[model samples]
Target: MKELEERIRREGAILSETVLKVDSFLNHQVDTELALATGREFARVFEGEKITKVLTIEASGIQFAMAAGIALGVPFVYAKKKKAVTQSDKVYVAPVHSFTRGETYQVSVDQRYLNAGDRVLIVDDFLATGAALVGLVDIVEESGAELVGVGCIIEKSFQEGRGLLEAKGVRIHSLARIAAMKPGEVQFIEESGNRQLIEERA
Candidate 1:
């Protein structure tokens, strides 16, 4: 996690509208070492939880989610960005607005992937407006799956994502939390709790 935080500080690009572009190492080009380390960190953080499956939305979430699933020894399921033609009738769907693209779209997963008794951990590369995260949570609820927690690599703390999830009684573990980002500069929040742990490593 320390390494991740450092990477964000050193290499992360802050695009317009609160978007943190980590395409060099994440979000676009794959960094297997860092991705695997992130997965192991997530597994370590949520070790005691009875996680049956690792759930994540498709696109950016797939790499980190798959890495975490591998480390947790569980199957990883990705919700499609849109309803696929082969999607089953028994599926959970949610309409999510993309803050980055300025568009609304649907994401879904097969009902068979999640069930009433299963424990799920949602993983993703970043947390911005929390719209996608909310949609993922909705899918979990629709399938009657227990959402144990959410794990994210980089979270923009200035956004409402963390607050939204916390209001829903969901615990979020973000490796790096950017309090603010300006041109050529990024600030990480220094809260006394987990934030301190992240800062200590920095």
Candidate 2:
């Protein structure tokens, strides 16, 4: 997690008070080593949960979910943002509003990949709006699968995502939590027991 925090500080671009772009290493051009390390951390944190599958929304969340699946020795499933022609009719669907894209879309997962007996661990790139994640949670519940927890690479703590998920009784673990950010500065709410703060400015 320290490495991740360092990367964010060094390479992350603070576009605004509400937007921090980490495309250089986290999402677009991914650092595979860092991603795997994050997966291992999630696996360690949720060691006893007996997770049977890793679930995420397609596109950005796929890599992290796949890494988690590899670490946990389980298969991963991604909810498609749009239904495909080949996809079956018997799928669990949930509506998600993307604040960034300014649109609402239906995310879904095939019923054949999930069911009542499985335990699911959700993973994602960013935990900001919680809309996409909440949709995944809904689908998991609809399938009657046990929700183990959620693991995120980066989280904007100032946002309502964490609060929304917590209100639903969901456990979340994020490697880097941004307490606040601005055009050229960022502050991280330390996760370590000491509660030490880490601040960076461009």
Candidate 3:
């Protein structure tokens, strides 16, 4: 994770107090090696849990979820941003507002992919607004899958996303937790706090 923090400090662009762009390496054009490392970290953190599947939202989160699935040796599933013509009618849906995109969309997952017997680990690229993560959590609840926890590549710790998920009893782990950020500076939360984060696992 220190490596991730270093990359962010060097390459991340902070447009404002609320916007941080990392598409250069983390998202749009990904660093394959680092992405795979993130997967291994999540697997190690959540080890011993009988994780049956890894879940994520479509587009950005796919790679990380796939990576985690590989590390955990389980299959992965992703919720489509919009329902496809071929998608099943019997699917769980939730409304998610993309703060960056400034719009909302209904994300859906096929009912057959998730069920009571599954233990799910929801993965994502960032945890800022928590809207998307919340939607995915709702779908997981609707499907009756036990949500082991959420794994995010990066997190804006100053945001409400963490509080919102914590209120719902969701455990979260983020590789780089930014306590604050501005146009030229980024502040990360101390690693000393992660022991509590890992211990609070559900």
Tens digits of per-residue lDDT, candidate 2, 1-202, equal: 8899989999999989898999988789989988888889999999999999999988989889988999999999999998898999999999999998999999999999999999999999999989998999889989999999999999887788887898999999998998889887888877873233322321
- State the local distance difference test value for candidate 2: 0.90
- The CA lDDT of each predicted structure is 0.86, 0.90, 0.92
Structure candidate 3, residue pairs in collision: none
Query: Number of the top candidate by lDDT?
Result: 3
**CA lDDT of 174 in candidate 1?**
88
Worst 10 residues of 2 by lDDT: 193-202
Tens digits of lDDT, candidate 1, 1-202: 6788788878888775476788999988988999999999999999999899999998889999999999999999999987778889777889999865899998889888899989999999888789999889888888888999999988888778887888989989988778778767887765345455333533
Tens digits of per-residue lDDT for model 3, 42-152:
999999999999999989999999999999999999999977889899999999998778999999999999999999999999998799999999999999999999999
**What's the ranking of the predictions by TM-score, best on top?**
2, 3, 1
In model 2, the Cα lDDT at residue 119 comes to: 96
Per-model TM values vs. the true structure: 0.92, 0.94, 0.94
| Candidate 3 structure lDDT | 0.92
lDDT of model 3, residue 179:
83
- Regions of candidate 2 where Cα sits further than 4 Å from its true position: 193-202
Candidate 1, residue 53: lDDT: 95
What stretches of model 1 exceed 4 Å from their correct place?
Answer: 191-202
Query: Which candidate order results from sorting by lDDT in descending order?
Result: 3, 2, 1
